[model samples]
Target: MHASAQSQQHPVLDYAISHLTDLIAFDTTSKYSNLAIIEHLRSFFADLGADVSVLPNASGEKANLVARIGPADAPGIVLSGHTDVVPADPKQWQSNPFDMQKRGSRLFGRGTCDMKGFVACAMAAAPVFAEGKLKRPLYFCFSHDEEVGCLGAPAIAKYLASLDVPPELAIIGEPSEMQLINGQKGKIAMEVTVHGDGGHSSFSPQHVNAVEYASRIIAMIGERSKRYEREGPFDQDFSVPHATTLATIINGGVATNITPDACNFIFELRSIDQDAAQTDMQALIADVEAALLPEMQALAPKARIDWEEVFSYPAMGDATGCETFKKIEPILPARGGKVSYGSEGGVFEIYGGIPSVIIGPGSIRQAHKVDEFIEIEQLSQCLTFLDSLDTWMKR
Candidate 1:
């Protein structure tokens, strides 16, 4: 039945929509501090009698929130989502990006689908899991800066691991259209800056051109990506089917008449196997420094290249066998699937020692779009699924 139609009997759906409305009002873009939204969530959960903790970054600008309901000594499932979102240009949107607008069956807003929708559902269900009779704990894991990189999840994972009764498994709510996501590729993101000297265009030969060297590195990355696509070390489960690397952003040069002084570029590798991918990344960086440094140094002794790690999240292997996964088997999708997108699941497993599954409301296609939205039907679907989860926990 439709979400609006089901709302009369489904108070959870009503509460979810109410929570989502308030959540979307926060401008939690990655570029800005998300402390406001984090505080809001903290208060909400604390008021409901759940144990809530806020882990802040060194700067105290961003934070990850963990909320627990039930006995502290019992293992439980984690409900995860990111609080931050990509920037939304007001010009591209029909209404204010922070204002949730109901249009037909969809709720339009910047983070309505990318995340906060699932967060709303989890929050709405908090009371259910907090009842005195709850057998095990229910943990809500929310992080910041996921749009930039999964910068906050590691802290949450580590914190969970440090607990006496850590989470056994996690449900990463990342706009999966309520389907079970068994696996996903990991990501390795890096930023490389080439330093050189600027000079007149006519004297380019005498001065090292940073842009030119950056292009060489980009070309090398392209060649490696091509080889991976053409060769056999592939996993047919992922849509891309192979490790892929590419330069996503680059900045260099000034006037057309002047040789650039410096160039900065960013690149990433999305891989089915993180070990192999990391190895390839290290080799690629080494080759660039070896091959291009000499040429640039020959012209200018001070010329050099620097590389910095942006951020990365591990790839999730199939989660069908996870202990917590089996509990919700009745509601899981009949068949499993893998995605090229990276998520906190892998890090939760590797870092927190928790197995994980990815499932949530809304399609990823709605994420980060001009008029981002989540279907009301999907909201109902998530509530129904959560009911099944509650039953499992009660049993």
Candidate 2:
């Protein structure tokens, strides 16, 4: 049905949609356990008779799966995708977010556009890869908690690094409307809680106001963001062309008449240079510890600030020059460049020492939004890429 805006109904497309339909049924939100979806993938890969390894995280609540088909001795390609999706609010959606709905050549579902579409395509092609006459192996790497902080990727990358011969490249399938992505910003998400001695409003000066200190810290981050915006060691390949710091959640004061005892806020920093960003954050902390903490401690001896890490992933450098890119360049739908958003592809490169690229079906504009969907044609295009990969492997 490639004519007149009709569905092509190819077997790969059909299989991918079938798998995607099942995958969307799973409520593998980042905050929830992803064991069920992990199990589904494990079973699927195991049934294919591939070399499948299910590596569970330390908490045993989530897991990552790596399945290798074809020749193992030779360096191969790794297809990576995340299983977790951001939580969906039913009230915000026109239909059930977890239930897959096919409408006018697009597949509607929560994870359909953000990821599962690519994962489904990858899995749908597993059988073909299994049976292909391959010179190099094809590896399928699926992980959990990717939506949260690339948490599942480290373990998968570690496992790949331990291989006799690591894969040649990692292609992360983050929704990019099928554009090739060579770079992305790294991220560190954290929560800061300021502790103080609460007292009546009359004694506010004597008591450390947690909300006041929290606001001060937020202001400091805002200043750093402004400085970066003004004097950026900029990367123009990204749409924003500059690093960013954002405080998304802040909670502090309980009552207007009383000084708050505690304040906590969650913030994130996205940068091209994560180490430098972290260094600056540490410097900010040192400045506060040296100056602000003592001032608060003068009034409340037990006053302190606590910093806890929520999640973190490294930024990937440009990989457009990698030999592997040349192998698949001819099939690229759009030009390659950097993206403002982050992906596990960065960790696959930085943590696992695998060169990486990002290209996949669907627009990011559809991801994490109400009525998320991926164009069915994109899945068809992805199938062509996967099949062409087999063609290259055989050559």
Candidate 3:
């Protein structure tokens, strides 16, 4: 247990803790407007003398903020976090989810752990970053729509790639309980739609049934899941030793009486090995089209099989035997390993050409859950960790 809000005269940490309350107060739920939260942050950064750029999404309902401090001439580090928070169920929470509450050492609120805390820490240090004369630059990249699909980050990453000088490294401040995560699995989300002729259920073999066809696709995915595990290149550290998947969405048939006209299922795969996963996925979809679609088309020439890639997060792996690890590895806990969860680290590693890691306060367990919170002690520890980075960057 620790003291409430601010315990001592650690100005930056205290500011971070207080700022978390303001950040958490905004209902930046993934479904709601993140514009308000992003605007607040924009003002904060501008006041800190940061050179700010706000990139709006297609709808302009959300924005991604890229702020740079220090010498733009040199490659630096990016501190990245998402502005959106997962929706909170009011009935499940003890206190108002938006109102930060302190009980013992923990600060209870939505987005407290899942990542406003990290954003707050970075925001608190804005002045220090702006004032310090440093060898390299520091970029703060805040994105939107991360919980949905890691959608917002790709655009920012693309912009960063276009920069004449991009960051040398990116530290994605995901809740790792202060552990450093050097690698993570890639994710691919696909929506498969099956269309066939509809007829009266009473008349058997008169028309195609979409639900049946959709079931076949589901079965195919299940088979693929098994194959991903039994195959080689397995990493034991991940919860799933190999690629894993499950159908998250399925919709078909208007009523129980009529034959189903169309069916759609959304499925996702988390893969440790990107190349093998992509190859398998391509082959599996081709097989389905070859084996399954032709039969449906013969029955009803209008039948269709469609697969649209909705989202993708590339696999992340730190280059082995690099000085980057030698420099930062000691700052992290000893148990660093891969995880099934995906992050913007992929965008930094694969797109930004910067080695990246996931390290911050809070627990992934508390993220996106009822009564989401971060321990005050964890925040204290995170301040120290940031200070270490500050020292490193200064050196």
Candidate 4:
């Protein structure tokens, strides 16, 4: 028998998998609007008798959906996910990525794993949670723009932070093949642009090579990376226990005969510490600009070297003794290790004071891939996990 058969089966989860095909049909690509899906969820939750709150983004094009089931006074768990899927090109996929198709044990689509699967499973369980005579509460939080540096969740988290009945814990249902994810690496994305005087290639000495100068800045970051690796404070569970990565996107240089006047590069670092991230970035950029810009401006005197912070997601630490962690361990096989990927869990940890953990069906490997899929067997296991959750709550 399927493990879900061990307890009273939740009809809500069954409903979720069936409706997931419909949800996946809409192209909620990160760059586009998710209004159709958001509206559908709003209606579905409201019909379930949940008090739904839809928070709109600046453009009013996308929204974050928050639904509560149970008494306001009771502390509860928030089941979190994003409504956006990364863009998928038809030519890159073997099947229609927007259309959910089922083969033996697998459902294939654009977002079958990178996370609509968890959202579907959570939605399937919602009705059951709503009907139960509960001691605690359950909150469903679906956000937009998670693919874009977790931009959508901050508003929702801020709203929750303002509430008198803030959630006690948050379970960010990012795919982890059912393991509990307790840690994440921090991230800092920046774009560095170098402006130098333009001159003829014959007079190349009179103008600075912006691309060359950008390479020097990139090199500076690389030197810092080595130091971050040997003498840093990262947990060993990570594949690389260090502040890793310095990627530069090279753009500019019109003709080989002309000295390139402007070059811009975008780079990022994934780390375990914020202060270390900032300190390394500031020091490296300061030194590189101090060394390079003066020589460039000697030709134009209007040369510039500057950077902008695009976005930042904090690193997560292990959550060994937290109430949220305690709630989920009994249902999972065993405690799992840290993952390098970033999630909205970091925001919940810092802003909501609600201990958060990432756990759900599917694998990170399959997430956001061309032929993305989740095993029906995994869905069955998730249903069983939810059953365990019901039993645990009852106890």
Candidate 5:
């Protein structure tokens, strides 16, 4: 059967897909502003009688949208998703990355799987939720800059916390294939800079080599990663089953004939235990300062090793006994696992003090790749999940 014909047969699916297509057309790349999409949603929800609030960044370029669809004075459920997507190259895609394409059972677009599908489904279900007599409120938290170290979700979470009656539970609609995701590793992104004196290659012995020092630190990171894998605090649920760390980007010398004066490398530690990761990172820094820095300084007075934490987010872990967990359990599948990728779910859990779970359509594998797509079946499953949520809220 043709997808369009099938969609027409199911108006709810058709509406959801229509919204998804509209959402994908917006170039809400993390590097650019998401204000355009934010405004569109603001007006769309306003027309639906939702109390919409836009939280703009200091520059007023990007913003987060918080739309409430029920009683004002009570705590309720929050449905959250990020509006920004990773940049996509047109040359790499079969179709325009920003234009949603449907072929067979799949819908292709930049954010189709990574998560605009879930957001669209949430939006499509809004009218149903608004029409119902709800005992509690329902919130749509659409945040920006999530692809870049979760920069926007913290602000949204902070705003929600300040509300007169904060939400009791938050459902972060990440690409979890509709299965409940109870936990994920925390991330700490850092940049390490090694500074040395530039000199001719022939005089390398006299000059401190920044690249050499960078290599030493990279090796140290690898050693620590292995230690964590073999040591305790392992959660078998995760594919890696242990916290991990790795160097992602590195750059050094300008010319082959010159000894590089500066070297910079970016690395990240994804950990199940954030405190342990912090302690280990500090120990690595101390090792460099005590053992490597002095020797480099002996050769060049200005030589130094500096570390900067670029970003960090807490780990999301088991909220099994919380009211939110019990309430959603009946509708959620029995399967639950940990994802390695980071999301705003942690911010909601740790900072907002709201017990949260990650459950939405599609798989993370299809996210942030060429020809990114989500299955039509997945969108239908998400609709069913939202229908269950609506029923739960009515009770």
Candidate 6:
């Protein structure tokens, strides 16, 4: 439908759009501080007589905002979204990525689809929740640095666990086109550094080549990736439906004529079978330590291989028959499925023991794209879902 027609159908849609425009104005890129946006949300919820708390990171430059409406003593639903967005280059976008622009039926902005659309809808519905006689509380959890590997969420989850009564269920608004997402693969990122002896290209065989060893590791990882694709114990709900490993970044060699002294590469495993993935990773490391290390050390005694874990988040398993699933199923349009992307939902579930699901407006495809946008109708539908949630909590 046309923008004018849709906007007229639901006045709340306009409210959501207005709030979205304001939110998009803040350039909360992961590299930049998100304190301004967190403070804005804190004041917005505080003005509505809700209890608000800002949990700042160690540097105090960024923070996570947790706001609650209705009875704080009772367990209730938590609407969670990240405040930080992936970096967007203005040269690639049609307009300023931080400025919300409406064209036809879509609203374009950096975080419009990746998340802020859902956050805007939640903000627009805050008053409705505050005014309603809710038997249970409604929480708003806005986190920072999610684009940089879900860094802020673990702290938020820990804080929630310390509460007298933590939330019963958490709904992560992570651009699932408003469909419920019940499961996602776990991810572990690591950087492998290989130390070797540097020598002239003319006498390469006399010294260990770090780049050659790095290539061997990459090839081993690729072979394991192929095995995962062919193995059993796969979940068909996910798009890929299997545990996978990939090497994302590789760097070695300073000059064409010199053998590199060190090689570094980053790789990750997205796995449905965390146990198997961990076992495989340990085996790979053991192999390097036992075999590769000896060969390299013979040439250079200090030659070694080291690994640094960069980031990791647990997986969300199927929640079809879970209590939280039963509670939220009626409000959802269809049965929940799995998503390939990672979010804080798994952290909430595994760390805080809070049942979690992902559902929100906009399409995941638009996230991190050149000109990300959310359909006007998607925001309107999300409003309806919030209204239903309000009524459900009252019951």
Winner by TM-score: 5
Looking at candidate 1, what is the lDDT of residue 157?
95
For every model in order, what is the number of clashing pairs?
0, 1, 0, 3, 0, 0
Q: What is the lDDT of residue 381 in candidate 5?
A: 80
After the best TM-score superposition of candidate 1, give how far the Cα of residue 309 lies from its true spot, in angstroms.
1.3
Q: What is candidate 6's lDDT per residue for 316-355, written digit by digit as tens? A: 7666677866876787766447887888988898778887
Model 1, span 117-223: residue lDDT tens: 99999988888777646687889999988877788998999999999989888989988889888888899899999999888999988998999989999999898
Residues forming the 10-long window of minimal summed lDDT in candidate 2: 1-10
Q: Report the C-alpha displacement of residue 10, candidate 4, in angstroms.
A: 8.6
Clashing pairs in 2: 1-8
Off by over 4 Å in 6: 288-291
Show model 5 residue runs off by greater than 4 Å: 1-10
* Total backbone clashes of candidate 4, pairs 3 or more residues apart or in separate chains: 3
Cα shift from native, residue 96, model 4 (Å): 1.2
Q: Rank order by lDDT, top first?
A: 5, 6, 1, 2, 3, 4
Candidate 3 on 130-249: residue-level lDDT in tens? 777767788999999898888799888888888888777788899988877777889999999999889788874878899999999899888888877787468986656788878999
242-297 in candidate 2: lDDT tens per residue? 88888889998888999999999999888987668788667767876776898899
**Model 6 residue pairs with clashes:** none
Each candidate structure's TM-score, on Cα atoms with residue i matched to residue i, is: 0.94, 0.93, 0.92, 0.92, 0.96, 0.96
Candidate 5 lDDT (Cα, 0 to 1):
0.88
Candidate 4: global Cα-lDDT? 0.80
Q: 1 or 4, which is superior by lDDT?
A: 1
lDDT for each residue of candidate 5 in 227-339, tens digit (9 for 90 to 100):
88889579888757898889999999999999989999999999887667788778878876887888899999989988999999888877767976786688775566888
The lDDT per prediction is 0.88, 0.86, 0.84, 0.80, 0.88, 0.88
